[model samples]
Target: MASLNKHSIGGNIFLLLLAAIFMLMGVYFQWLYTNESNAALAEEIAYQKAQEEYHDSNIYYEPEASIRWLLLRQHPAGYFVPNPDLLFEPTQLNDNTLRATRYAISILYELGALDSINPKTIIEYVMENYLADIQSAGEVDGAVYHNGPYAGFGTLSSRPAAVRPTMDALLILNLLGGLDDPRLDLDRVNKFILAHMNDDGGFWDEHYAQSGRNSSLRCTSFALRALSIIQGHQKKGFSTSDRERITSFVVSTHDPASGGYADFPGREATDSYFVFRAFISIWSLASGDLAERREYVENHMEVDHTIDYLFGQHYLKDEGAFSRYYRDLQSVSSLKATNLIIWFMTSMGRMEVLPEKAILQYMMSKQNRPGEFGGDMYTTYSALSTFSRLAVSTEPMSQPKKPTRHASIPAYFPLMLFSLSLLTLITSYFTKKHEMEARNHILARQASIDGLTGILNRNGFEEGLEKQIGQAIRHDKPLALIMMDVDNFKDINDRHGHIVGDKILKEITRLMTENIRVYDIFARWGGEEFMILVTEAGQDKAVQFAEKLRKIIESGFFGIESKVTCSFGVAMYRKSETIDEFVHRADEAMYNAKHSGRNQVSTVPTSAKKDDRVVEFKP
Candidate 1:
C-alpha cells in the first residue's frame, strides 16, 4: 500500500461528517413523529372513555310526556299547530295545513294516543282545506299542472293539486275512515297518481317538475303509497310492466359500495333521509309478509350488506351516535343523525343491529320540553315513531365495531406527503393531462347510448352513418340500409300500455342484437322504429338478414298478448346518390311493406334509380 495523500484524507473526513448530519436529522424526525402520535392516541383514548361513561348513564323513554308534547302541537280546534317556533301561531296564510296535521296525527297514532285528538274534527279540517269542488274549484294554479276532477291537494289551501300533499291527505283521511266520504273522489285520485308515475317507474311532483328535475325516491314513495291506498290493495294498482319498471328504478338507486339507496340512480346515499325514503318505497312496492318483503328488497338491493353496513361505517364511539353519512361522523348533529338512523333501521326491519343504549340516549337528548324533538314536526314524527318501534324491540345493546382505520397516523402526515410528492407530481403533470383527455373522450362516446335500451340512438346512428358513407365512397365498397318498424305498434300500446310497449321494444332489440353480425350497426330510430347499416354488403345480404330478423320477431312473444312482428325495407347504396336519397329509398320500401299488410320484407333492387319517388310513402 502507498502512503495516503493529504487530499484523500480530507475527502474521507468530509464524507463521515455528512453521514453524521443525516443520522441526526433522522433522529429528530423520529422524535417529532412519536410526539405527535402519542398526543392523538391519548385524545382518542380519552374520547372513547368519555363515550363509555355516557353509555353507562341510564336514560328513560317517557310515554306520557311524549304524548303531551304531541298534544301540545295540536290546536284546540284539532289541526296540529303549524309552527313549533311559535307554538300555535299560523304565520303564513296556510300555516295550519296538512303537513303538521299529518305528522302530529301520525306521531299520536304511533304512540298509541290517536284517541287524544278527535278524529271527526281532524277530518273536517282536512276536507275544508284540501278537498276541492271540481267544477267550482277556484282559479287554476299556473305553477302546477292540474287537469281538474282529479283528487290531489295543493301545497296551500287555495292550491288545487300536488302529489305529496295529496298523499298525506289520503293517508290522514283514510286513517279517519273518510274514504267513503262523497266529497273525496277515489277514482280521480287514482287517475291523478297514475299520471304522475313516469315510464321510469318513479313519480314526479308537478311542482318540482317546473325545475326540470327528474323523479326522486321521496316522491316515488308518496306516489306508490297513494296508489296502493286508492286501489285498496298492496300490489293490484300497478300493471306488471309498471311494477317491473318501478323495481328497476329502485335497483338503479342502490349504491353497492355504501350498501345504501341513493336519491336516484348512480349516486351514493347522502343521508339517512334518502335511505329512509328508499327503503320505504321498496317496502310499499312489496305485497307480502316480512320474509317476502325481505325477498322483494333483496331483488332490488343488497340486503345483507345494507344490514351489516348499519353496524360498520357510520356509527362512531366518540360521537356516541350513528352519523348521517357513512364516511362523515364528525361535525354532524348527533340528535338528527341518531334519530334518522333509528327510523331507517325500523323501516328496513333491522332494528336488531342497533346499539340500543347509545341510540336512545342520543335521541332522547334532543327532547328538552317534556320532549319537543327535532325543533319541528317532521323530525318530531320521526323520533316518536322510532320510540314506538324501539318500545317493541328486545334487542341487546352493544357498541358497534368501528370500521378499520389508521388509529395513529402521524399528525404531520400532510407535510411529509407534500415533501414526498413534489418530484412525483412534477413528473406526473403531463400524464394527468393525457388521462383527463381520455376520460373526456370516453364520456363523449357514452353520451350516444340510449338510456332505456342501451342501444345507439338515432343521433348516434346518423353520426356513424356519415362516417360509413365516407368509407364506402372512398373504397367503392358495397353498403346497404335496412329500416324496420314494429307493425301496428300504436295499436299494441293502446291495447296493452306504454310500459308493455317499452318492454316489447327492448325484446325486439335483443332479438335483433343476437342475430346481427358484430360489424352491422343497429340502432333505435325513435319510437317503434329501428335502422341498421350493413357494411360491405349489398341489398341481397341486407334483405336476407332483415327477413331473418322478421321471422325471429314473429316467433317470439314480447310480454304482450299478440306476437310481435317487424316490417323491413332494404336499399342498396348508389355510389352516385347522396345519403338522403339512399335513406329515402329504404323508408319508401318500408312503407310499401307497411301498406302491403306489414310483417313483410320489401327491398329496393340494386337497379333502382337515385331520384325515383314513391308518391304514397308517408313519413
Candidate 2:
C-alpha cells in the first residue's frame, strides 16, 4: 500500500510540471498574436485617417460675396482694411512693416498672386531688396545688429531687445507659403538660430547677445516658430529633449499675476499679444500638452479685458497685439490690430471669435476708388482673410462661439508618430531578416576593391566620381580632376601576361597616394585612367599636385624589370559645365600629354575671363 501511494504522488508531480510548460507556451503564442493584430489595426486606422484628412472640400463662404461686392464698389483697383487714427503706424514699425508686407504677399498669393506674378521673381526681390535689413532668426551675435533700428525698425523707444527681422522674413515666406523653394537660404538661417540658444532653453535678444541667459517671450516664440518650419524639412524626428526644453521655457514665462505670458522669464509685465504668439509657436513645434494650456486659458485668461482691446473698443483694457500697446490706444480703428487678432485666432485654429463677416465688411468698406485700400498691409491681410474664410465656409458659422479647444488635427504629428512606430517595427524585422544580406553588402564592397591595387573597380570608380563631383559642387569647393591613361598599357599587358600589368597599375596608385595631400581624393579613373579631387585647393595648387603625382609615377614601378609611366590631364571645375564636359576636358588634356610625350601633366586655364587654354607638361 505504501509503494502504490508513493507512485501516485510522483505521477501527480509530473503532471503539474507538464501543465505549467503548456501554460507558458500558450502565453507566448497569445502575445505574438496580439502584437500582430494590433500592428495591422494601427496601420489600417492610420490609412483611413490619412484619407479623411486628404479629402478636399469645395466649400465657399456665403459672406465673401458681400465683402467682394463692397470692395468692387468702393475700391476699383485694390482692397484695404480700415485704419483708425492710431499713433503707431503699422508701416512705421519696421518689424511690423516687414511682417505686414509679407502678410500682404501671402494674402495676395491666396488671392491668386502666383497666377499674376511669378513666384520666383517675388522671391528674388525679397532676397535682394529685403533680407539684408531683416533680423535673422534663431541665436545671433548682437554685433550683427549693432546699428540702431537696423532691420525691423525696433529702436530703443519701442523694444529693448527687439531684433527679430529674421523671424519676420521666415514668417513672411511662410505666409507666402514658400518654405519649399529651393532658392531660399534656409541653411544659413538655421545656423543663425542654433547660435543664439541660451543654457536655459530660451533664446536671448540682441540686447544681451552673450552676456547671460536673458530670455524674452517674443524671441523664444519667434525662434520656436522658425525652428518648427525648418525641422519640417529634416528627415530625422525631433528628439523629445528639444520639444521639452521649448515647452518649459514658454510655460515658465507665463505670468501668474496677469493671466498672461511675459515675453520671457522674470518679466514683470504680462501681455496677451505676446502670449498669443508664444502659444502659436509652441503649438507649431508640438512642444507641450496643448490640452493643458487650453484648460489654463479657459479658466484663467482675463477674457473681458482681452476682448475689449482686440477691437479697440477699450484702450489699455486690451493688451496691444504686437508690442506697441501704448501707441495702439490712439488708432481706434487701426487694421493692424484687427489682422493681429485674426492671425492669432487662425494660428490657434479658433476662427469663431474673429468676427469674420463684420471684419470683412469693414475692410471692404475702406477701399479707395483706385482699387487700393487706404489701410496698410496688415489691414489688407485681415480683410482678405475674413472675406475668404467666410466665402469658403458653406456651413453657416456664427461669431464668438466658444470653440472646442484641442479638437483640430495636428496635420503632421499623429501621422509622424504612426510612421515612426511603423518604421521601428519594420526596421527591426528587416534587420533580423537581412542579417545575412548586410554581411553580403560588406563582402560585395570588399570584392569591388582590388586589395593590391587599392583602386576601385570600374563600377565603384564610376559611382564614386559622380558622387564626389556632386559633393564638390554642393559644398562650393574647388575640384581638380585628373584622368590619366597609360600611353602603352595594352602593350604592357600583352608582354607581361596581365599579372605584371596589374602590378604596374598597383604601383602607380601607391605612388599617387604618397604624393597627394589628405584632402586630395584619387581614384582609378578607368582602364589605365585615374581621377583626383583637390578639395578647397586653387587651380595653381591643383596643377602643382598633379605634376608631383605624375613625376612619382614616372619614376616608380613594381619591379626594376619593367619601367612604367603615366600621362595626366588636369582641369578645374566650372559652374556651368556638366560632368561630361568636365571629364572630357581632363581626358583631352591626358591625350595631349601622351601625344606631347609620355610621363607628363597637362592642364586648362583657371582664369574666368581667359579662353580655355591647354598647357602641356614638361616634367
Best-performing candidate as measured by TM-score:
1
- In candidate 1, position 387 carries an lDDT of 69
| Candidate 1 lDDT by residue in tens digits, 1-619 | 2346665666666644544444444445544676666666777787687667646744555557767777766665567764544555666336336777887777777767777778988887777655454434644442343555556676566665767878888888777778777777777777677667667888777656652448777778788778778776322545678888887877778778777777777887656566656666777777767778767766776766765565565667655676666554444654556666676566567654577766666666677666567677776676666667677332334553443333354545534433344343333345447877998998777777776788998889989998999999999899989999999887788789899888999999899899898988999888888999999996666767788788898999877767788888888788887888888878878877885668888874334566543222221
Question: What's the CA RMSD for each of the models?
Answer: 21.1, 29.1
Model 1: CA > 4 A from native: 1-57, 82-88, 92-96, 131-148, 209-213, 233-236, 308-313, 325-331, 334-340, 347-349, 392-619
lDDT of every predicted structure (CA atoms): 0.70, 0.56
Please give the lDDT score at residue 303 for candidate 1: 61
Model 1: lDDT to the true structure: 0.70
User: 37-90, model 2: which lDDT tens digit per residue?
Assistant: 666566667666655543422223333433342333211112122332332444
Query: What is the lDDT for 521 in model 2?
Result: 59
Looking at candidate 1, the ten consecutive residues that score lowest on lDDT are 610-619
Q: What's the count of clashing pairs in each model shown? A: 0, 23
